[model samples]
Each structure stands twice: as C-alpha cells, then as structure tokens.
Target: MFTGIVEELGEVTRVEPGDGVTRLVVRGPVVTGDAKHGDSIAVNGVCLTVVELSGDEFTVDVVPETLRRTSFDGVEPGRRVNLERAMAANGRFSGHIVQGHVDGTGTFLSRDHDGLTHFAYPPELSRYVVEKGSIAVDGISLTVAEVTRDEFAIALIPTTLAATTLGRNEPGDAVNLEVDVLAKYVEKLAAVHLPSAAVDNGGGEEDR
Candidate 1:
C-alpha cells in the first residue's frame, strides 16, 4: 500500500520495448535511496515492482495490460512523473490509503485562478466520488471540492502546484486516477442487501 504522499518528482530516463513487456527506468534519488530489488514503487499512481536498481535510478517492466490501462501507453523519456515509495509498516499514515492501482485515466480540464482544478473522469466512477472524498490523481492524494456526473474538482494548494506532476500537466493531458477503496467496498457490501443489485450480479436462491 502507499499513502499517496509524493516523495519526489521523478523523470523517466529510458523506455525500452520488448516482445511482451516494456522496460521503464526512472531516476528518483530520494525514492531509490534505500530501494532494493522487488520493492514496489508508485509511478504516477501505478504500482510497479522494481526489477533493477542503479545509482539514482530504478527499473520496472511494464506489461501490455498495464500500459493499456494507464497513461503510460506511449510514455517516453524525459516525462516527469509522480513517485512514492510504498508506505512502511511503522510509518505514519498521513494520507488516505492508496493502493497505487490506477482505476482509470482522467483528462485534465482546467485550473481556475483560485486553484480549483477540474478533471473529467469515467462515468462509471462517478458514484464513488463525493464532495470531500479522497482521490488520488497521479499518485498525489487530494480531496474532492466539487463533483458532477462525469467530472470532479480539487482545490490545489501552492505546494501541490510546485511539488508534483500536476503542476506541469497541460489541458487534455491524461492522468491516472484511483478512487477511495473504502467507498468501493461500501458499495460492494451494500449490494448484497439491495434486491436489484443482487439480481444484476445473477444472485438468486443459490446465493441467499
């Protein structure tokens, strides 16, 4: 698990394509300071296992499935990405729980003068987002300031503007988004008691 607290902004050093997987090397001295092989790192909200480590760089192999599901489909060198090391067992849980699993990609729409930034999310995820709910955008934990059927807004503080990848994101840029897992769990658990929901999942006498 990750805390969605971005430790540093990492830069993609290389992207090598192979038959089935692409090798991605990122330079993050802070996150890779004590990193070892097989450690998990969050790259723009996507959990990736470190396969190799160098001086200030770590490498991970990205499978096709991950590529298709994230904004990394055609990611290239020199792109700045949010980086966070997995939370330590004894570390303080400063932010909400972040699985580093990107649920879907959202589009950066606009940032107003007041730092109210808006993004268009997938319609299916609409139900999980609520005002004041927690959401991870490109691995940085943020609270929802407003929500609509297909979009949500976050109030970005000055620190967020200067520290993470969101600062450099342009309009229409794709960002990885992960909604609060607890909300999803609540929905799933509540579905069991909702007659229509049970039927939608093909539940019947056998399930009861």
Candidate 2:
C-alpha cells in the first residue's frame, strides 16, 4: 500500500521495448537511496517492481496490460514521473490510502490561480467520484473540491506544486486516477442492502 504522497519527481532515462513488454529505466536518486531489487515503487500511480538498479536509477518492466491501462503506453525518455516508495509498516499515513492501482485515466482540464485545479473525469469512472472524497492523481492524494458530470476539481497547495509532476501537467495531458477504495466498497454494500430494506418497508405501497 501507499499513501500517495509523492517523494520526488523522477525522469525516465530509457525505454526498451520487447515483444510484449517494455523495460523502463528511471532516474530517482532519492527514491532509490534505500531501494533494493524486488522492491515495489509507485511510478506515476502504477506499482512497479524493481528489476535492476544503477547509480541514481532503477529499472522496471511494464507489461502490455499495464501499458494499455495506464498513460505509460507511449512513455518516452525524459518524461517526468511521480515517484514514491511503498509505505513502511510503521510509517505515518500522510496521505490517503493509495493502492498504486490506477482505476482509469483522466484528462487534465485546467488550473486556477486560487490553487484549484480541474481534471476531466472519464465517463466510466465518474460514478466513483464524489465531492469531499479522496482521489489519487498521478500518485498524489488530493481531496475532491468539486465534482461534475465530466470533471472534478481539487485544491493543490504550493508544496504539492513543487513536489509532484502534477505541477507541470498541461491541459489535455493524461493523468492516472484512482478513486477511494472505501467508497467503492460502500457503494457495493448499499446496492445489496437498499433493495432489501425497501422490500421490508411494505414495498412502499402496502404501507399506504
């Protein structure tokens, strides 16, 4: 699990394409300071396993499925990515729970001077978003300030602007988005119980 708190902005150094997978080498001195082979790291909200490590750089392989689902499908060298080490067992949860699993991709819409940034929600994923809920964008946990049919907004502090790649994102860019897992579970439970509760209440007609 991760907290979605970005540790650093890393750059992709190389991308080697294989038959069905691609190997990515990223330069992140801070995140690799204590990282080891086989460790899990969040690269732009996607959990990647370390396959190799060199000075200030680590490598991971992205499979076809991952590429198709994430914005990394056409990732190239020099692309900046948000990097974060997996949360330690006794670590503080500075941000909300992030699984490093991108539910879908959202398009960067626009930004405001008052720190409010907007992202266009994917139609299939909009049902998972709600006002005041937690959402992870490019691996940074942010609270939803507003929600609409096609977009959602969040307030980004100066620290976030400086610490994550989100600060550099432009309109029309694609971003990885993960909705709150808890909210998804709650919705599932309500779907199962609400109908039963209605039936127990005389189906709303027998009572009258």
Candidate 3:
C-alpha cells in the first residue's frame, strides 16, 4: 500500500518491450537511496515491483492489464513520473490510503489561479466521486473541492503544484484516478444490509 504522498519526480530512462509486458527503467535517486530488489515503488500511483537496481535507477515490468487500465500504455523514455516508495512500518501516515491501483483515467479540463483545478470525470467513474471526498490523481491524494455530474475540482496548494506531475499537466492530458476504496467498501456493505436493517426497524413505521 501507499500513502499517496509523492516523494520525488522520477525520470524514465528506458522502456523495453517483451512479448507480453514492458520493462521500465526509472531514475529516482532519492526513492532508491536504500532500495533493494523486490521493493515496491509507486510510479505515477501504479505500484510496480522493483526487478533490478543499478545506481539510482530501478527496473519494473508492466503487464498488459496494467497498461490497459493506466495511462502508462504508451509510456516512453524521458517521461517524468511521480515516485513514492512504500511507506515504512514506522513511518508517519501523511496522506490517505492509496492502493496504487488506478481505477480509471480522467481528462484534465482546466486549472484556475484561485487554487481550484478541475478534471473531467469519466462517466463510469463519476458515481464514486463526491464533494469533500478524497481522491487520488496520478498517485497524489487530493481532496475534492467540488463535484458535478461530469467533473470535479480540487484545490491545489503551491506544494502540490510543485511536487507532482500534476504541475505539468495541461488541458486534455489523461491522468490516472483512484477513488476512495473505503467509500466503495462501505457502499457495498450498506447495500447488502439495508433491507434487513429496514425490516428490523419496522420499515420506518412506528409500532404500538
């Protein structure tokens, strides 16, 4: 698991294609300072296992499924990606839980000078978004400032604008988006028990 806190901006050094997967070599000196083979590193919010390490660069293989679901389908060398090492057992939880699993992708709609940035939400993923809720965009955890049927806005502080790939995103760019997993779990549980709970409460009707 990840905390959605970006540690550094890493640069892709190479992208090699295999029969069924693509291998990426990324340079992240800071995140790999003490890294080892098999460590988990989040690249643009997608959890990738470290397959090899050389100097400040590490390699990871992206499977077909991950490529299909994420914006990494056509990733190329020299691309900048948000990088975060998995949180340590004793580390502070600075951000919300992030699974590094991209649920879908959204298009950058607009950015405002008033700290509010908006993204056009894909129709299928809109139901999981809500005002004041937490959402992960390209692996950065942000709070939903507002929500509409087709879009949502997040208030970005200067730190956020400077820290992650979001700072460089322009209108029409695609971004990986992961909705709050807890909310989905809660919704599922509620759906499963609501009927029974209603019956136990006399279906909202008073009984003498």
Q: lDDT values of the candidates?
A: 0.91, 0.88, 0.87
Ranking by lDDT: 1, 2, 3
Clashing pairs in 1: none
lDDT per residue as tens, model 1, 121-149: 99988988999999999999999999999
User: What is the C-alpha lDDT profile of model 3 across 14-124, one tens digit per residue?
Assistant: 999999989999999999999999999999989899999999999999999899888898898999999999999899998899888887888898888976999987876
Off by over 4 Å in 1: 197-208
TM-score versus the correct structure, for each prediction: 0.94, 0.91, 0.91
Q: Which ten residues in a row are the worst by lDDT in model 2? A: 199-208
Q: Which ten residues in a row have the lowest lDDT in candidate 3?
A: 199-208
Clashing pairs in 3: none
What clash pairs does model 2 have? none
Which candidate achieves the best TM-score against the true structure?
1
Q: Give me the displacement of residue 190 in model 3, in angstroms.
A: 1.3
lDDT of 2 by residue, 102-187 (tens): 88889998999988999997876677788998999998999999999889999999999988887899999999988887866666
Which residues of candidate 3, in runs, are more than 4 Å off? Answer: 194-208
